[model samples]
Target: MKRWRHLALLLMLMTLALLALPAYLERAELQLWLLGPAWCG
Candidate 1:
């Protein structure tokens, strides 16, 4: 539903931000960005 889509978008943005950071909050952020679409889908 709409909520899921919104959450997915938010996570996508987080993933992008985390990816662009020189020091990430966690290394896993990269994996989340790489796989978020499949996981979200």
Candidate 2:
């Protein structure tokens, strides 16, 4: 039972992180786009 609870918590955190990753990447990409090619180059 204790192990199941721990696994559940880990799974929840992983799910949240996975869901958040794309949004985070999109925000980062948007910031980079705003910065422009010359700035990145």
Candidate 3:
């Protein structure tokens, strides 16, 4: 296998992870932040 092809595959996997994790975290943070006011009060 060539170097660029391997690098491209690695980059593609990284981009996919970035897209998935942020959306997951966003939903998680929204839930946590919403509960913060009640918990703190």
Candidate 4:
């Protein structure tokens, strides 16, 4: 119900972020941005 809609909306926003992020940063930087936090631990 309402929770499903909220989850769907969050997923859509994440997909949009993925699509829009590449245009804002270089491929290498983008990879680092995605992986940086994991490597920090």
In candidate 3, which residue pairs get closer than 3 Å at backbone N, Cα or C atoms, i.e. clash?
none
> Which candidate, 1 or 4, would have the higher lDDT against the true structure?
4
RMSD of each: 12.5, 2.8, 3.8, 6.6
Pick the winner on lDDT between candidates 2 and 4.
Answer: 2
Per-residue lDDT of 1-41 in model 1, one digit per residue for the tens?
Answer: 99999999999999998777765545578879988999999
lDDT of 3 at 32: 82
Q: Any idea what lDDT model 3 has?
A: 0.93
Best by lDDT: 2
Q: Write the per-residue lDDT of candidate 4 for residues 1-41, one digit (tens) a residue.
A: 99999999999999999998877578778789899999997
- TM-score, every prediction: 0.51, 0.57, 0.50, 0.57
Off by over 4 Å in 2: 29-41
lDDT of 1: 0.85
Q: CA lDDT, every prediction?
A: 0.85, 0.95, 0.93, 0.90
Which window of ten consecutive residues has the lowest lDDT sum in model 2?
Answer: 31-40
Worst 10 residues of 4 by lDDT: 21-30
lDDT of 3 by residue, 1-41 (tens): 69999999999999999989989899989988999899899
